[model samples]
Target: MILLCPPGVYKAQSDTHLLAGRVAQLAHGRHVLDLGTGTGALALTGARAGAQSVTAVDLSRRCVATTRLNFLLHRRPVRVHRGDLYEPVRGRRFGLIVANPPYVPSETSVLPRHTRGRSWDAGPTGRAILDRICDGAPEHLEDDGTLLLVHSAVCGPERTLERLAAAGLSAEVVDRARIPFGPVMRSRAQLLERSGLIEPGEHLEELVVVEARRG
Candidate 1:
């Protein structure tokens, strides 16, 4: 319904909606956890799909507020928490977990702390947040639960599958979308090419949704 994204808050984009679609499909009867719930799109989708409960976590206060505001606007309920990934929901397991974290490959490996870059400036390999999510997801997912992660292919979706598999989860790419580079990707195109993450003159990136299941 109404999605108000202030200056610093992330606007719900294609990736967010893509994951939300899957959230709507799998969230029924589940306790859902949405990591990086920027605008609460996915969390709200989970609730709309009849989730038992929905909890959204974000490190940015602005994102947390925006997510809550969106929930209020739509009359949906959610537990919005302001904390880094998995920190606020420590030891709490969810029947379904969804994430659309930053997966843009940046110049350095260091993640942003307070700046707007924290929204999309993922580390050089773009696994800064992705890896952490993979490593921590197992403990936070109930048996038979599923984790849905959407990220750019340039950051290596296969690596995500590998990491999750190493963690004893059955993982696979469930969906993919190829779109022309957005502003951020256009700006970092040259760097990505130089770093061998993409081909020279490549103006498109494939966004993939990887689903990992705990059994």
Candidate 2:
């Protein structure tokens, strides 16, 4: 199987861990979109999994260029575009849209540093990005298409499901795993107080995969 390690020149965290293979499992002969496609890991993985077409979007020009390089290096046919969220592909629908958006509560928090405003920060409660994604995802997804997202389980999967429900979508936790806490863990802990993120004395968590679909 072809693999993409990581890209150089961006301290931006990956959209998803083990993203390359993770996406391949869900993508098959479908048009796929990888939001915040750093290093094109997920996008390339989807392509190798036989996606009909794969498009990667990032706000960073460097990420866009890096994704193109990685795509060419892997001989994967993926279109890399520099844009925020769904701007580049506005009005276009996909069978699958995958994102590992910045779920950390604060952009200024010490974790992995990338160019400013890269969509990694999730605001004070870390739900900022999640909110937008939940609200806007339905518009971009086909009736039966799926939106796959990775975030901290600490972000309250129940809250996320509620937000999606409010947006006229149905969401469920498809996969979840634990990883080490980076510097941002501190702030998330504090914000949890306000958002009821998780409970105290609960084990700290790293990532969660939420797969939702529009009705």
Candidate 3:
């Protein structure tokens, strides 16, 4: 599908494709939600996979515009909203929710306010947005619904599993891939090593897809 990613909008990358592949497997005829839907990559993937309906949420206006443009260009109908995480979809639920959130560990405790960094920096420990997604997803999911999330192992996949389980969902690491560190991770490799989040001289991080189901 044709997508126009203007300045400040995140371009689809490996993590996006990883989540898109999983979404394609399960989105057929299901109501699918795409959180942090940058470039509308995963949302378009779901629509192409025969999802009955697709709704996408993003905090960036540029991203929202870019996704809407992609949906129109591809002749795929997707409800696009601009808001933080689930804010735009309050009181709604879906059969499938997919996310490829910002997971690159950052030095600051507070997430970036306004910069390209917002696309990848997730504050110290890299759980700023991931934690929110895990905590709130159960409430937004229909019974027997599934949540598919992709992130770097540097953010602690085990913690995500525990949080999802604690939220009353059965969660597991469904997929994993080792990829070389991108610009963001490479820039902070030293800090990550000092924090013991990664081994010294490590140039790669494991990307994991955590699948959580609400029974």
- Tens-digit lDDT string for candidate 1 (1-215): 56888998778888887778888899999999999998888898899899999999999998999998999998987899999999999989999999999889898988887888899988899899999999999999998899999999998888999999999899999999988998999999989989999998999889999999975
lDDT of 3 at 131: 96
54-152: candidate 2 lDDT, tens digit per residue: 989987777788788888888778888887779999999888888877776663444343654444566666776677778878888877888888888
State the displacement of the C-alpha of residue 174, model 1, in Å, after optimal TM-score superposition: 0.6
Please report, as a residue range, the 10-residue window in candidate 3 with the lowest summed lDDT. 105-114
Provide the overall lDDT of each model, using Cα atoms, as 2-decimal numbers: 0.91, 0.73, 0.92
Candidate 1 runs further than 4 Å off: none
User: What TM-score should be assigned to candidate 2?
Assistant: 0.82
Count of steric clashes across candidates, in order:
0, 1, 0
Superposition error at 66 for model 3 (Å):
0.3
